[model samples]
Target: MPVELDPVKSAQKRSDYNGIYRLEDLTRLSEAVLSDSGQVDVMLKCTYDEQKLPVMLINAVTDVDVTCERCGQPMPLHIELAATFTPKTMRLEEDLVPSNYAIVEVNDYGLVDLRALIEDELMLEIPLVPKHEVENCAIKEQDMVWGELDKAAYEKPSNPFDVLKSLKNPK
Candidate 1:
């Protein structure tokens, strides 16, 4: 079934959900202007831990088209994310969150928009610097020569700080 969940109630029931959603339907993802039409497959479960903390687990996979930073070409990337979230009835201090899980707020209405949550996670998964594999990239020539000093300049270059040092130290 779909993943629309009331986090609190779902946790009580220890329910499991599975669904597929079109990538285009996630408006935030469209902001990147991705080139491909894809679908996100999601698996969700709501349960409690040994401490009876309300927890939600999500596993999702999808393909996304992103621009390669080096070549400026669209590349298809496969993304899979698995994470766990803890929902609190009352706002808790950040320090109270355990190391292994994330805290998601349960709004006053008690509805958790799983779609938006997944979208947020997907956004975070995008690479800060997306690039194709080095072998596949077209920038080999530019990369090789990017920092090379001009071999044609045979003359020794004058020191830029020589005049300043001479003025200050009078040596």
Candidate 2:
């Protein structure tokens, strides 16, 4: 279910409300934006303050099937994310920033697209270097070969001065 925020009521000091959201709604969001193979499950408790600031206290567990970066094998990943999202009306200066974090805006009526918000949060939680932990993974040999090739490509050449010295020494 979507959350509705009444800005007028919020501005009048009628804030501090809570609600329970479901996991199926989050899955639908993943289906719309993510690949069909991707899956997400989430539950969140949302709170609003008198300033119309929405704070989402989220606890989520997800299993996503994605191509592994290290081994080229299909990897199934499990992730648990617990975080809070705060909606702000104004952007703070860089010097005064609390921390480096993402900020989303609340609409005039304080209505937020929970689907989109959760989807984005899940995307951010994905690992940059995905890999499988199982031993003897199908692509392990292939990955080793690729690693050797990469090492060769980046290896430093022997110093020309050193080469000349070696030649002079006949060693």
Candidate 3:
């Protein structure tokens, strides 16, 4: 089942969850993806560290199709997220959290929604300018240039700066 557990309680109990979440369920992610027909494999574990601080470690993997910026064609993209987070509770100060673990806010019920977390991480993994490899892309670097340059521009022998030279040495 989709993970939605109280971080504080889960940490105390040392809970673990592994499952698949539908991409279509993630509204924001679905909108950005080319097709909302995929699943994210999620593995989550909640426990305390050496410092006895409640923390959760999560890993997720998924694939989506994104429009290539270069050719505007659909290209497959893989996403993976592996992160450790410390639950931020009223008693836990942000500064006290360990540097290695990111701080995650708890809901009103002190629960951590794994689906939302996966969605956020997956969104971040998407590239700002998606593109295929140079060899595989339909549009090439050479083809990116605009229409051919005017041959007359380069062939013209007369120098426009000659007028300046004449002004400097008015013979």
Give candidate 1 regions above 4 Å deviation: 1-4, 91-96, 141-171
Candidates 1 and 3: which is better by lDDT? Answer: 3
lDDT of 1 by residue, 1-171 (tens): 353578778889989888887887888876774653788899998998776778899999988888888889888788888999987666555676678898886667877778888989988888988998888887785474665577667678899999898899974
The digit string of per-residue lDDT tens for model 2 on 31-93 reads: 433245534455555555344444555666667666677667667666677776565545533
Q: In model 2, which runs have C-alpha deviations exceeding 4 angstroms? A: 3-39, 48-54, 90-102, 134-136, 141-171
Cα RMSD for candidate 2? 7.8
**Against the unseen true structure, what C-alpha lDDT does each candidate score?**
0.81, 0.56, 0.87
Tell me how many clashing residue pairs each candidate has: 0, 0, 0
Residue lDDT tens for model 3, 80-148: 999998888778877777787888877888887877877898899999999999888989878876777
TM-score of each: 0.79, 0.55, 0.81
**Candidate 2, pairs of clashing residues:** none
Model 1 local distance difference test score: 0.81
